[model samples]
Target: MFECFCCPVCGQALIRESQTLRCSAGHSFDIASGGYVNLWVTNRTHAGDSKGMVTARRRFLDSGAYGFLLNRLCSETAAFLRGRGEKDPLIVDAGCGEGYYTAGIAAYLRRQNIPATVAGVDISKAAVRAGAKRGEEVSLAVASLFKLPLCPASVDIVLSVFAPVCGAECARVLKPGGLLFIVSPGSRHLFGLKEILYDDPYENPPNTYYLPGFRQMRQFSEKREILVRGGQMNDLFAMTPYYWKTPADASARLAHLPTLSTPLDFHVDVYERCEDDAQEPPVCEHQTHNQ
Candidate 1:
């Protein structure tokens, strides 16, 4: 069903047979019992999220704290597809953790009567396994965002939310005029939480939205206040980069907090793949963060 997927080893098309995917070049990958495939060809032992982190993220997302963001993503993507009159489009959720947005976008497009194929890829087996258990009508793969396992010029849209951005890899997979949506944190994101965690809380710096072989189309930014309740606070904290670097004292401060009222700021940048192969020189460093 995932015609867009190619062999990571040989760069050849993959054909599914029973519980295995094999390419003509003799490279084969086994589909896990969770219904997700592992196409991560990495020599590095550790990559992506751990099981604990994935669980936290899944719980936090399922609580619907990020519902507004999800709705905006679906609306924008659906509108783009409708405007292009594309009845069937291939969408890839790069670094899709637990398939929350992937499945959501696919379902939304279906409700709008737009049949689309959605594929989710992450570098974490734990995350992809959890995603497969959801039984969404989308393909899930354990693969790197920097090195996708999709065919060249095979995807119509690529979505990245709080994930790493690999401009060269994205350009290779997208067809000319395809769209790439990058969702990053705005300057004031989580200001309240930062205030409690750091003695001198500072606003997030602006992002340099530069990508090779891509031209800026438009941007969508939103900020909203969210009340973190129950265990959601810890879950939210675990999904952010602060969890790794925050001092123990800061963490203890957060622990004593009964509830966290933080401003959630997100910026969605839409870029269109250039028709010509010409690309601008690299202008900015890529930022990597937890999803």
Candidate 2:
């Protein structure tokens, strides 16, 4: 399933022996006991969610608060895969946080009689570890979207949900005609929660992403009202970026609300990688040429 991984230093296909992933150049990475691996070369410089944030995210998601969107994502993505005509698909969850959506996609695909191997990559080691604990079906790795651990043109589908968009890297790793699923907040997303936090809250602006080799194929919008109670409210707030930005009075107001019927919106877009007339050459160490 992870035959796509290559050594960062030598660009040779990585082969696994026991718990170690090694390439022809002798560069090696050890798989963590938690069933994930760290392919991060310079992870310290990257900004990823902290352990507390992952804990909060896991708690909030486990509540099935986003079940509606999750179901839609699975159904729509599966339908796309069926239409794509790949018997076995390799699905990736880019920047997957704690693997809730990743597992959801995996389960859906499998239930629909479609065989798919789901892998996930997140910049956060904590996040990857949490995801590894969720299931054995997913191969979780700690890596940045900027430098994907997978080899060029190796994946069939890439899923980015509420994660940073690295269009170039995503395009680099996808095969020609590969599918890219991007999920983002819509205009009405979280307006209910925001209204309690400030005197005036604005609707979320439309999100946009530009991929060099990708063109939009289709899009789906999902909106629903979610009734969040006190504990779940705190869980939601603590897991969101708004938690840090909101003022003290806002926190007090959110704390006081026993229940808030908040509206959530998600925009899912499907893009297909276009064929390159002249594919870019792969960079490798110890460059070889015919003598």
Candidate 3:
């Protein structure tokens, strides 16, 4: 089902050994029994997949708090593929944290009888390992988004849900007519948590960086207010990065929150690669000089 993978470094065929990937260049990466390979070679790992973070993410997702977002993502992705008349789409979730969202989408596709090859890649080995342990049908790999371990123009669709996006790399791996779906938290997402954690939430600014490589095709938003009560509030707090830098009183405040109704705002932006612009010079000239 995952025959499309290749060596991240040499771009050669990756042979699946007992629990590892061996390329023609003798670069071998061990695949955890959970069925995901670790392909990250960088020394600096992002703040992802630590035991506590993974556990928090799993607990929060399993609670069905994010079910609405997952459902919307699955439906939109499926509809997009169906409209394009594409069959057996290859999908990958970049920065797939704990595999909840990836697993959810894969299950949705399977229920619809859509032939698809789903793989979730992350820089966190722990996250991929957890995803692998979840079972088959979804391949998990510890790889960087900046350099995906796949051949050029191989994937049919790419999903980036609350994760980072490397526009150039995504465009390179996607077929000419493929689409990339990005889901990001809107400015108002998690406002309640922000209000409790920081004294000046507005001063920190928000993430509004947009990709420059692809043309925007469609944009839609999904908002749901969840009334998180009891211990689940703590789970919600831990799952978010806001808790990390929060003051000591943040946790206390969360614990005291009898009922927190926060908006879960997510934006789904679909973009198609501009084929004609593929051969054009660098769009960000400053990047060339920095290199």
The numbered model that scores best in lDDT is 1
For 9-103, candidate 2 gives per-residue lDDT tens digits of 66788898988889988999888889888888873675688888889889888888888888887887788778888767778898898899888
Segments in model 2 whose C-alpha atoms lie over 4 Å from true places = 277-291
Cα RMSD, model 3: 4.3
Across residues 192-256, which tens digit of lDDT does each residue of candidate 3 receive?
67777667665222344345556788778888887888877888887776666677886787788
The worst-scoring run of ten residues by lDDT in candidate 3 lies at 282-291
| RMSD of each candidate relative to the true structure | 1.7, 6.8, 4.3
Candidate 1 stretches greater than 4 Å from native:
280-285
TM-score, ranked from best to worst:
1, 2, 3
**Could you estimate the TM-score for every candidate?**
0.95, 0.91, 0.88
Q: What is the C-alpha local distance difference test score of candidate 3?
A: 0.74
Worst 10 residues of 2 by lDDT: 282-291
Using TM-score as the measure, which candidate wins?
1
User: lDDT per residue, candidate 1, 75-147, as tens digits?
Assistant: 9888888887765788999989888899889888878888888999998889888988877788899888877
Worst 10 residues of 1 by lDDT: 282-291
* Candidate 3 TM-score versus the reference: 0.88
Per-model clash counts, in order, read 0, 0, 0
Q: Candidate 1, clashing residue pairs?
A: none
